[model samples]
Target: MHKRFLIIVIGLFLLFPLLGRAVDSNQQILQLRAQIEELQKKANEYRKIVATS
Candidate 1:
């Protein structure tokens, strides 16, 4: 019974944070921006190739 209680308490401690919104890391934000830029460049290049052919 004591072990079960301890397990329940620990579960709540971890779950509490997930109940609130979280922050994104700077590295993650920068990576997303780079991905968007690369996709846009590829799209423009594809459009040019289609126009030529």
Candidate 2:
């Protein structure tokens, strides 16, 4: 039982960083998507101006 517990602890310790990195990567993806949307809006506005001129 002690050995099983130790193995579980070691496995969790190794997995913790991967889980944290997954969360961090998700946040980065969200930020990048927001930036892309903002840039797309600016591009549409520019297109409208060009069309008007």
TM-score to native of every candidate shown: 0.51, 0.91
Best by TM-score: 2
lDDT of each: 0.87, 1.00
Residue 38's lDDT within candidate 2 is 100
User: Which prediction has the highest lDDT against the true structure?
Assistant: 2
Q: Distance from true position, residue 46, model 2, in Å?
A: 0.6
What's model 2's overall lDDT? 1.00
| Counted clashes in each candidate structure | 0, 0
Question: Every model's Cα RMSD, please?
Answer: 6.2, 0.7
- Deviation of model 1 at 6, angstroms: 29
How displaced is residue 38 in candidate 2, in Å?
A: 0.3
Candidate 2 C-alpha lDDT tens digits along 1-53: 99999999999999999999999999999999999999999999999999999
The list of candidate 2 runs beyond 4 A from truth reads none
Clashes of 2: 0
